[model samples]
Target: MKYLVGVLLALIVFNASAQEEGGLKRPDIPGELMVDVGFNVWTSMPGGLERRTWSSKSIGIYYTKRKAFSSKLSFNYGIGLGLEKMSLGDSSTLASAVLDDNGTTSTDDDFVQSVLIVANPESFSKNKLATTYLDIPVEFRFHPLGTEDGEGLFIGAGGIVGLRLNAHTKWKYDNNGETVREKTSGKFNLNSFRYGYQIRAGFRGVHFFYKRYVSDVFKDPFPSGESPVMTTVGINVTGF
Candidate 1:
């Protein structure tokens, strides 16, 4: 009898949440759970060393609920795991500079510099770290055209907040026509936090997404005393 009562209480909470303003949705076929995977290309730098941008991909699953007051407006949120892999651009200028990684002098000729003007790796290719994060997204979706009876286009705008989990760096070089790998301390801010905002448009289950970063990859933009801005372009696989 106690077990039965507990089950009943759980059902009541679940049902009430599904119907309330902030809650999950009723299990149905038409709902969308998005999975996003794409690459980010860094455009310009604070200093001006052009390094090859690598691939950064993320996967997230969102549960959506359309409001009864207006089917055109809805709310969605979910969790995900993300990874960022960065490679520095090989340059004589960058290779020649001396870098201070947390007060350690590294003359390895490949130390990417996170600081500037004072003597650190070039701004573009310093600190090649692959960082991991746990992400949570909250979005408000607007459907303008399609009513309940037909298909229409919708737009979603919102932000994502993430917590950093791990970070590392990989050093790759050619050895007698063969590849060699060395691991270095991937010392970087990794932001302790990662996040961005996105604008999306789509019809039905497919949507196009443009996400922009609002937070800096590092706490200090420059060791030299300057600010840096980085951005990327991507598409949402599960769409809007």
Candidate 2:
């Protein structure tokens, strides 16, 4: 991790130094920076998750660098951070601490799914499993009329490599007549590394993106029959 960061930083410094020694240069031919903001939808989920799943949503953003290759072509790449959540079907909150395996499910033939032994399931309005990541993004971009001018249509194809930041469960509920909320932070078997490819396109800096993590969502010893590898599709509203 440190090595990758060091190399990227070194390259950035070298580029900056070269530009300084060469005197002033055109911003368009030099480079452009951007940030991505969008949502995520999980695809190819296995059966185990379906039984307890509701709406799954994610939020993402990235900071990128685009170095022009011509009036219509460039290479875009950079780093950013993001967050995601998968809302389970059951309303019952997790019973265990951070990564404890004691968070037993509440479903039963005799007991209703709406009820729980660990938490008063009826009190909560929402409960979800969430995760975070630190990402490095890369793309090959084409700017139809060049970026030095005003707005233009742009397209890119590439991928990103992300390191898992953290994972947890969060919920908000009414205790008596008051609202109560809590968040548990831990790695619930998520892998340390995630990588995937994507395609991006947009007009005037507003872009849309789609990507799938090449790695699984969890590490070994995960509960059997749960395929949680995630596929994300979202938009990058603007850049700077």
* TM-scores for every predicted model: 0.62, 0.65
List where candidate 1 sits over 4 angstroms from the true fold. Answer: 1-32, 46-49, 53-69, 92-128, 147-152, 175-178
Q: Write the per-residue lDDT of candidate 1 for residues 1-240, one digit (tens) a residue.
A: 232245348656865666746665664445444655455544444454444555343334344444423667766666655555555554311221345658666755344444332322323223344566677777777777545622367787898777877766655555566655645444443367867887777764566666676777666655444444344445555522
Q: Which one wins on lDDT? A: 2
- Mark the regions of model 2 whose C-alpha exceeds 4 Å error after superposition: 1-35, 44-55, 92-124, 144-151, 173-180
lDDT of 1: 0.54
- List the global CA lDDT of all models: 0.54, 0.61
Error of 1 at 26 (Å): 15
**Cα distance off (Å), candidate 1, residue 166:** 1.3
Once model 2 is optimally superposed onto the true structure by TM-score, how far is the C-alpha of residue 155 displaced, in angstroms? 1.8
Find the 10 residues in a row with the least total lDDT in model 2. 109-118
- Error of model 1, residue 148, in angstroms: 5.0
